[model samples]
Target: MSKKGKEKEEETMTFKLETAPFDPRFPNTNQTKYCYQSYIDFHRCRRIRGEKYEPCNYFKKVFTSMCPNAWVEKWNDQIENGTFPGRI
Candidate 1:
């Protein structure tokens, strides 16, 4: 594909949180499965130095202290793999 075409495709891509009735089978480890919008909000806040630092609080609460090392591992895996099952 042409570079222009690829750029257009990337621009058109919409990253949205997939929503449905919460799956009891879903592992809470997948940050993408929970309130995904919330995740995005938190992530952005941290990146932009937004006034609200608490946006990513859920991430810290659930992933950081709860399973600290695992969170880093998951992030590394996502970086290597391009996309994870839940988190974009």
Candidate 2:
């Protein structure tokens, strides 16, 4: 492969994937509440701190890793339509 192509591959490979760390609040094997809380916290953070706030991404990453894709999509739609059950 060309040097440029190798460099591009290396750049993509540099990313590190991780799941949400263990939290004392949710010690059981079931992480549903943890995932949901992260989702709520992410939106709340965004609402209070604005979309550009970097810390908000931490919650986003946690929820995205822990919640199922369909759940995330439904929650996103609910938030858009002002139907989300959780307070933000």
lDDT of 2 by residue, 1-88 (tens): 9999999988887767899999999999999999999999998999999999999999999999999999999999998999988898
Clashes of 2: 0
lDDT against the true structure, per candidate, is 0.55, 0.96
Q: Write the per-residue lDDT of candidate 1 for residues 1-88, one digit (tens) a residue.
A: 9999999999999796533344465557564534444344455566676546775565444434333476557765875787754443
The CA lDDT at 53 in model 2 is: 100
How well does candidate 1 match the true structure in TM-score terms? Answer: 0.30
After TM-score superposition, what is the CA distance of residue 8 in candidate 2 from its true location, in Å? 11
Error of 1 at 76 (Å): 3.2
Best-fitting candidate, scored by lDDT? 2
Candidate 1 wrong stretches, greater than 4 Å? 1-52
